[model samples]
Target: MDCILHTERLTKEFKGFVAVDKVDLRVRRGDIHALIGPNGAGKTTCFNLLTKFLTPTSGRIVFNGHEITHDTPARIAERGVIRSFQISAVFPHMTVLENVRVALQKKLATSFHFWKPERSLDGLNARAIELLREVDLAPYAHLTTVELSYGRKRALEIATTLAMEPELMLLDEPTQGMGSEDVDRIRQLIKRVSAGRTILMVEHNMSVVSSIADTITVLARGATLAEGPYAEVSKNPSVIEAYMGSASVELVGAH
Candidate 1:
């Protein structure tokens, strides 16, 4: 399979410390690749580098056969790589429909026209509603963003990112801070949304990651501990020691 995103010896350094240390990663076209790690494992740093939020200290980043290591975030985004934050990132003062409309306007490159109402943009309202429905937020389309529950806000974030029409999505802990029911809902939404694109996410929830990840890469102390299917990773001694060892066994069991 062709890799839509590939990094060769990708490294990031902060002063004297190495955050991401010479890692090689490949995300195949249309595959949902999960990056799993403990806190401070440099997963977010990797995403930032890939998105060109931070320039890599060393190594190369290629997207669709183009060397994009030095590209700007907007340039990278223009090439169809978009990231959704771990924190809910929508306009709290805006209505649900308006929030999605903002995303649509940006995607349509109509954000410069301050005088034009969203309805005036070509296909804007219809496209916004379609994205809302895709994320299961159409029912609350007219409600204020602040009125929606935390879980729904996350869903809205996904919908907004989808409105960008990206070919590859980088999701940072998409289900963070949600209850079991909400987690399940977002998990299903992720699977639904990723049908035609590549998805790379940093997730700590084992059951959720195991259930949906087409391929899992385990990170430990800023390096890959294991990379393979969940079943293959589950039995790896290094992965077990990093996450399910005796010290962490109780915590894993509690979940």
Candidate 2:
């Protein structure tokens, strides 16, 4: 399979410490690839490098066939690669419709047209409403963002990312802090939204990752320890010894 994103010997050094060791990563077109590791395992650092938020100390990052190791984050986003954070990112004071409208406005490059009547902008309201519906936030469209639950904020975040029409999305713990129902909802939303797009997510919950990930990469101590399909990686002795679960809990339930 052709990789939508590929990293070769990617490494990041902060002063004398290496946060991301020489790690190679591949996310194939239209695949949901999960990156899992303990805290300080370099998952976020890897994300930073991929998104060009941080320049790598060494190695190449290829996206859609071009070397993007030196590209700016905005330039990468223009190439249809986007990432959402573990923390909620939304204008809590804005109404749900207004929040999504802002995101759509950014993608449409209409931020400078503030004087224009928002309703008159072709497809603005329609598109925002569509995205809101896509993430199951339609009913809350007119509600203030602060009125929505934490999980709804996450859904809104995903909707905002979708407005960019990304080819690949890097999600950092998309379901963090969600209740079981909310987790399941977001999992379903991810599946629904990622139909034709590739997703690389850093997830610690075995059950969540197992349910959604097409492939899994395990990192420990800032290096890739193992990688494969969920079943294979779970059974790998190295993974079992290091990342089987919190305290080697039976992974069977995860699947």
Measured against the true structure, the TM-scores of the candidates, in listed sequence, are 0.94, 0.94
TM-score of 1: 0.94
Report the C-alpha lDDT of model 2 over 8-107, residue by residue, as the tens digit.
9999999999999999998889899999876788998899899988999999999999999999999999999989998899998988988888888889
Model 2 stretches astray by more than 4 angstroms: 117-122, 244-255
Error of 1 at 50 (Å): 0.8
Tell me the deviation in Å of residue 141 in model 1: 0.6
The candidate that achieves the highest lDDT relative to the unseen native structure? 2
Please count the clashing residue pairs in each candidate, in the order shown. 0, 0
RMSD of candidate 1 to the truth, in angstroms, is: 1.9
Over 84-134, each residue of candidate 1 has an lDDT whose tens digit, in order, gives: 987789999898989988888888788898897645864677888999999
